[model samples]
Target: MKINSTVLLTLILLILMLGAGSLSAFLGFTLGSSALKGVSTPDGRPTTKFASNKATNAQQAGLTLLKEEEILKIVKARIEGKTKAAKSEKLDEDDEETKSSKQKPEEKPQEVVEEKLQPGFPVTAENQGVTLSVQSVRYSGGDLLLKVKMQNKGADSVRFLYSFLDVTDDKGRTLSASTEGLPAELPTNGPAFSGTVSIPTALLDDVNKISLSLTDYPAQKLKLDVSNIPVARVAGLL
Candidate 1:
């Protein structure tokens, strides 16, 4: 069927109007989208300056944390240094104490001396029989104790009838003495006979000399020196 021109024109116009409406709707949607994108949040307006301010705030916070960390490190270093200095000071103090202790006075050692004695009296019709010797003298209990060893040098045995031991102080005071009752006898050509004689404590302080003599024995003359004995620090009676 052949279409009328008016109807065709009317159809064309309606189509054009629809197209224009579509175009206007699409442009409106595009403009609305662009405007919405350009708008800020409901709280306030938006700008590059605001974004820059947020970034600056973030950077400043980070810088503040860094500065705080640096300050903390410095404080920690200072505390460690103080602890080390304290320890060093303590060590120096101990060293000084040790040095001072080493400078104190020291004690001296005690000395000991020995003496020997020989008989000087006649023993037989021709010659002397034996000799008496004092080997050592020691001071103990505020007194001096003499150790005497006698030897019989004669060919025959000799018996000591009576003997005596004596010790004198620096003032000629008799410190110690043994009578004949305490005589010690020895056999001929045998080992020496040993005996101990003790002096009184009262005379020990002034004792500077010692004498050992035999009155009735075959060998009578005998003597010894014992002046280097250490003085007793404590009283003998106590």
Candidate 2:
């Protein structure tokens, strides 16, 4: 009654396979029952204790959980607060600027009033057979113009240079003037020479009266002086 060697080896292998299968099946059942117990309530009912991994993680980390809507509301409130603060700062700056502008005074330009020669002209002065007359006085192109006539009634020829003419204001300040249409030389008993003496209105700003003096050139034997010529400047003209 001796068994074959092949049959003995096959029987041993079959026993080992059955034992491994049983052991694996028991281990799987035990692990499954432990997992079910972990997720079950005390009343033997199934529970969702392992659900919502995010909430579980939050709890573990000791962090407060907030809904999306609540987060958005907080962010919006912060933004609105910042905007209001910026607006308030800008308004304060604008108010300060307005107050500064109101406290300063406005500047005005200096006004230059025009002047005119008054009436009672045609003044006359004579010395040593020489006569100087102011025939008229008027305004031309912002200048005070005086029409003058000169006569040499002497025995010798007299030379005249208007560059030597002296003109002064009431304050004894010298005035600048220009002359035109006058002869350089006057013969004895010659025809009366007429000319114009122009004075700038700018020099007459504070002048109320003027004086004029003239003398012959090279000889200077004759001296003519005209005084008390009036200058009038009224307001309201540009």
Off by over 4 Å in 2: 1-119, 234-238
Clashing pairs in 2: none
TM-score of each: 0.34, 0.47
Clash number for each model: 1, 0
Q: Name the best candidate (by lDDT).
A: 2
lDDT of 2 by residue, 82-115 (tens): 9999999999999999999999999889789853
lDDT for each candidate structure: 0.59, 0.84
Error of 2 at 28 (Å): 99
Q: In candidate 1, residue 71 scores what lDDT?
A: 92
- Residue 32 deviation, candidate 2, in Å? 99
Give per-residue lDDT, candidate 2, residue 96: 99
